[model samples]
Target: MTPTRARYDAVADFYASGWPDAIDDPASLRLLTLLEPIAGRRILDLACGHGRITRELARRGAAQVVGVDLSAALLERARAAERDNPLGIHYIHADVTTWSTPDQYDAVTCNFGLSDIDDLDAALATAARALRPGGLFVCSLLHPCFPGGPNVSGSWPSGGRYHDEGWWQATGELSSLRRQVGANHRTLATYLNAIRRQGLWLDELSEPEPSRDWASGRPDAARFPVFLVMRWVKATAQP
Candidate 1:
């Protein structure tokens, strides 16, 4: 769950409040659900904005929860919540790409944060290094293959191919949130290969359907997958 530097900081207000704790979206729900048996676990949430997932992980039984992001304004909101409610979640303001600790985690999670980071390889390495041997890594993302419909822009700009992997802005009429901070458009193979390169092998995957209301309105997008959730595990060290 890492966000780009100044980009995320600029929209701190919109995200600090709007990105809620409860997992309402299918992708979010699937990601959290895959992060099961959370009791007595140490989890690191990368790109954690305003500690939404961090707070939830602590509430759900993560013994030690750490949230890291580069947005100070968002961390302020998260810290304020901690002060008010005391969730014991530690929030760090740092770029996930450069941040590292000798401490490892039982699980590492990033929710819709991969594309936000400018350097995909560095971000994956950050997540990989945070995990213990065979530790779990769960995440959610916008479907790579989704050629968005109606006002929503697909993974790439219109007239561009899915193979065109690079940072692109969303001009979708309904995608106001993404318009504020554009995302990197990578191919499905790129994401899979990158994770594998980081030694995080795929374990399971989910392509969740969009909400009925949303699908009903955007039939073109409805015909294709909208959200993706993936569970991966760090391969045990080779002897």
Candidate 2:
């Protein structure tokens, strides 16, 4: 694994144990709904953290679900979760940017994982390559316009400004997390660009607001973008 991947592997245990919210995020359910994987279809959960959606897909009766991530630590948690449910999922430790498979999948998913990847474009291309013709790729990211945007200038609910210092960027467009990590910003445009570059067609885009509690804190967030869900389909050969 690359150094980046190694970082996650080393911290996987802590992430899984300490970040329960990360593993049990509602975003997984939301993204899974967009995917709508049929029974007996193969699906790939790119950057499947702690088997959140991977195990969910198995429970929903997918024939085969493969969850791949660069972090062995995260994969270890995923494997442990599978052991409990005994789902027939295959967890592979891999860097999503370069991992390749001879087989194709009916659907590919990456929930809230794209923004954290370093080579966003290369990762998207890898996803495109793994899809069968007409296969769908569904993923979610932090909303690009408000908190997720380059300019984190927004009105706080408490009568102050909540600002994040950095330039807004899209996936593969060069961005950093907390202004240090190599994570990329996954703006809507950036995502679309990557999809087109990979020869896939955009199918849908959605902005999901936070739940009641979160909304209650920053009511204005309802009017702004907080999270984005995107779906793309591979184009088929034409005569």
- Show the lowest summed lDDT stretch of 10 residues, model 2: 152-161
RMSD of every candidate to native, in Å, equals 2.2, 6.0
lDDT of 1 by residue, 1-239 (tens): 45455687789988866777776877887888999988899999998988888888888888999998888888899999999999789988888888888899999999999988888899899999999998999988999999998898888888799899999899999887788899999999999999989988899999989989888888887998889899999999853
Alpha carbon lDDT of each predicted model:
0.89, 0.70
TM-score of each: 0.95, 0.79
Top candidate on TM-score is 1
lDDT of 1 at 199: 89
**Candidate 1 — what's its lDDT?**
0.89
Q: Encode model 2's per-residue lDDT on 111-130: one tens digit a residue.
A: 87876677888898889889
What TM-score does model 1 achieve against the real structure? 0.95
State the RMSD for candidate 1. Answer: 2.2
Error of 2 at 109 (Å): 0.4
